[model samples]
Target: MNSSFGIKHIAQFILFVALQILLVDNLVLFGTGFCFIYVAFLLFLPIGISRMWLLILGFITGFTVDVFYDTIGIHAAASVLLAFLRPLVLNLLTPRDGYDTNDSVNIHVMGWRWFLAYALMLILLHHTAVFFLEKISLQDAWYTLAKILLSTLFTTTVMVILQLLFFSPKRERVDYR
Candidate 1:
């Protein structure tokens, strides 16, 4: 990657991780679904990025968050899993026309339906893995499952709202000669 692209991602990494640690982590929804908005950084990565890089980015992001959360490697594990599964999820949801190099995995570009499906699936997977790993017991299976579902729904909502507010679709200009 070029210097600028690298720099942009670095900035995003810092911005997301800080927000997760300092802000969203404390914004627990009814003392359950902690906002993991940091995952959006991985979700919003460029479509053309290599799988290896995806894994690396995911690990680094999760590891950074884990450092703050002091929860061993739960975040890292979930993030890596999400990164590994990302391509499979994209392949499963590939459009009939396929993807454009310039196409991003944002709501505007992928449409609300595709974006929701994609985000919800990943968010649920990540939350399930994280909560299960954190609890590490079936003693309260029902409660754990409820936490996973609630966290997934809350995190997914936050991701969608952030996309709607901050990120916009690129528009190509039309020229007539």
Candidate 2:
């Protein structure tokens, strides 16, 4: 990848983590929905990134959040699970023409339907792993399921808004000779 792409991703990683720690962490809704915006960073990573790097990045992102949340690596494990399943999800969602090397997982590039499906599935999986790992019991399966579903919806909505507000493609000017 180019230096600019690398820098952009690094900046995004820091931004998402900071947002999660500072803002989204305390922004729970209905006592069930928790927005894990940091997962967006992992979900939006370059489509062509290798599996090994993706796994490492996943661990790093989750571990960083784990450190601040003091949740003893729950975030790390969930993030890693998200990373491990990402490729399979992509393959399942692949377009007939396939993805361009430069394509990203944003709405502008992938359209609302594809992006929503992508975000929802991954976020659901991430939240499921997280809440289950935290609860570690089926005794409160109903509550845990509620938390997972609500959090997935909340996170997916925020990710879509963030993509629309900030990650929109910049238009280029063309001059006819």
Candidate 3:
């Protein structure tokens, strides 16, 4: 990681970890589902970010969440999976040439459709991996799948709202150049 980017990355990761564990953890809606805003921290990494760095962030994010929940390696594995597939997801949705260095993956800049599809796909992948890893022994795939989908939908909603309010590109278009 570039030294400057490393600082920002760590700050974002810590903020997300704290937010997810402290606030969102208690904001459970249905008994079975809750929002996890932390993953978006990883999701919002710049398009040009190194693949390795993104994976590292994913590992840290997942591992932190796992530590809070007392699961063994569920978060780590799922996070790595999500991080690995992130580039693939971006490629599939927007393509490499389509994204600018400053362009965001959030709802506003990418439009409702691209943003929704991108977030939905990754959330599904991450949640499914985590949910199933946690349930490795039981193997009740249906129940696990349901939990993943439900929780992801809720979490993705929070992500969209946050994107709209905080990181949306509509506010400032100042050129970095």
**Candidate achieving the largest lDDT:** 2
Cα lDDT tens digits, model 3, 1-177, are 356656766787888889988888898656767677888887887777778877887887888898998888787888889889989998898754577766546566678888888889988988887777777756687777668878998998888888878784762222333
By lDDT, the candidates rank as 2, 1, 3
RMSD of each: 4.1, 4.3, 3.0
* Model 2: per-residue Cα lDDT at residue 175: 22
Between which residue pairs do clashes occur in model 3? none
Q: Encode model 1's per-residue lDDT on 98-140: one tens digit a residue.
A: 9775456779878999999999999899988999999999999
How far out, in Å, is residue 21 in model 2?
Answer: 0.3
lDDT against true structure, model 3 = 0.78
Number of the top candidate by TM-score? 2
TM-score for each candidate, following the candidate numbering: 0.93, 0.94, 0.86
Clashes of each: 0, 0, 0
List residue ranges in candidate 1 displaced over 4 A: 171-177
For all candidates in order, the CA lDDT equals 0.86, 0.90, 0.78
Q: Which pairs of residues have clashing backbones in candidate 1?
A: none
